[model samples]
Target: MTRPKREPRRPKTVWLDDDQQRAWRQLLALVMELPAALESDLQRTTGLTTFEYLVLANLSEADDRTLRMSELAARANSSLSRLSHVVRRLSDNGLVIKSVCADDGRVSVVELTKAGMRRVATAAPLHVAKVRELVVEPLTKAELIGLGRAAEAITDRIADSG
Candidate 1:
């Protein structure tokens, strides 16, 4: 006689316990509020949105103050289309220049103009002050290190999955 067929196994659902739930809620609040706070400060002080500042800052740090459009998008944590729009605006404002790469005619590159560097230089101190006030000052050194490790782990997991 043949044995009966085994049913497919269902995946286990791991629900958060009360303490875990509380911690998750706290994290959720930070995730929602932190970016808004940073954006507000940056916008008010620098007339640049957080994303725009990120794009400018990345270019400022890059070799020759230039980066490929795709690389800049990844560094800025933005989509290519979004970066294209932002670059267009920056180009219009004379803060950045986009051109075909000399080495690779097919690829586009963005260069931070002297004006772009000046913009970031003016903005960096204010952004750093806001970051210190909102994030660093409140945390003890140990807590700050732990937070960095946790962020790294989460980012690594996300990158791996994606």
Candidate 2:
């Protein structure tokens, strides 16, 4: 029996109106510039990349300063492979240790070392100051709340689509 042929799909185009175009442009500029500025500040002060800091910070916030490798990658917004590499580097530096989960041998877990805790503790104040200087200090309370809501909405949309 012959299979039926499927119809070709039409590509949909979204053309932004003037206000939307302006908003998109501003968001685009922010997406391009903000990370670089933050990364530069982090690298200059702590010799840690933004990703490294994120990994450390997320681990610090976790219960017992430990998380499964997969969970850490999601929290860090990193790929599993990338997280593995970063974890290896951190291990080499004595910042974190990775071991097989006691309950599940197939699962890998990462725990922040005492040294990692100390490193993050040292970096936190400087990072917070930089964040205030670059992002928070200039915004009014209402604007900050609006920004947070906007970010949450956008992230929700992205997460739903993906």
Candidate 3:
């Protein structure tokens, strides 16, 4: 049998006030646009989504190109379940491996495969260029610094509240 459809959220309950609306729209646009743009570039050049690339990049930079699954999830801005799903895909692609952590039997760690390292090395420059083209070059150096600070502040706020 088919499942019943879920009801949609009512607009009045979810809608934002004027200032919140403006901020929400701008934030939403950045949220949607930035990932799509970066992911497209990554996909075009390295055949990976931004999320996948982030997974590899984080692993590659970690000591031994590895991290505990729970930690990797946090660093990659993904949930443990989502990270597991992605890691499974990466494992299938032979770009990452998951196994029991030596220090903690209950935990798993993810490590970059040699192929994943090579892929990230090849993709990093092109990804950086795309970032410059879409985000960095348009701003003054001061604005760039401010952008970093603002992003960190927002991240902290989100983390605190979340």
Candidate 4:
């Protein structure tokens, strides 16, 4: 028996209005520029890339200054493979130590060392100041709260889609 032919469905394309287009383009610009600016600031002040600083900072906040590699990857918004490479580099620099989890030999864990703690402590103030200068200082309290809510909503949508 022959099967009947079927029509392909096209996705709906809703074009943005002028105001929306302008707002969207501005958001895109901010996304691109903000990370670059923050990275530059971090690199200049601490000789660390933003990702490296994030890794260190996240670890510094954990209890006992330790986290499982997988957990760290999640917290850093990184893939396990990418986190492994960075953790290795950090281990070599004595900023952190990588070890087999004591409770689970099959699992890997990382601990921030005194050197890492010190580095993050030194970098935190500079990073915070740069963040305030670029992001917070220009916005009113209401605007900041609105921005936060908007971000959370977008993030929730992204999570749902993913």
Give the Å shift of residue 40 in candidate 1: 0.6
Clashes of each: 0, 0, 0, 0
TM-score of 1: 0.92
Give residue 14's error in model 1 in angstroms. Answer: 1.9
Q: Relative to the true structure, how large is the alpha-carbon lDDT of every model?
A: 0.97, 0.95, 0.92, 0.96
- Clash pairs of candidate 4? none
TM-score of 3: 0.82
Which candidate number would show the highest lDDT if scored against the true structure? 1
**Residue 152 miss distance in model 1 (angstroms):** 0.6
Q: Write model 2 residue lDDT over 26-137, tens digit each, in one string.
A: 9999888989999999999998998999999999999999999999999988899999999999999999999999999999999999999999998889999999998899
* 2 or 4, greater by lDDT: 4
Predicted candidate 3 versus true structure: per-residue lDDT over 1-162, tens digit per residue: 999999987676666799999987988899899988888778988898888989999999999999999899989989999999999999999999999999989999999999989988999999999999989999999999998998999989998998
Cα misplacement distance, residue 148 of candidate 3 (Å): 1.7
Off by over 4 Å in 1: 1-10
TM-scores vs. true structure, each candidate: 0.92, 0.91, 0.82, 0.95
Among all windows of 10 consecutive residues in model 4, the one with the lowest summed lDDT is 2-11
CA deviation > 4 Å runs, candidate 3: 1-24
Error of 2 at 56 (Å): 0.8
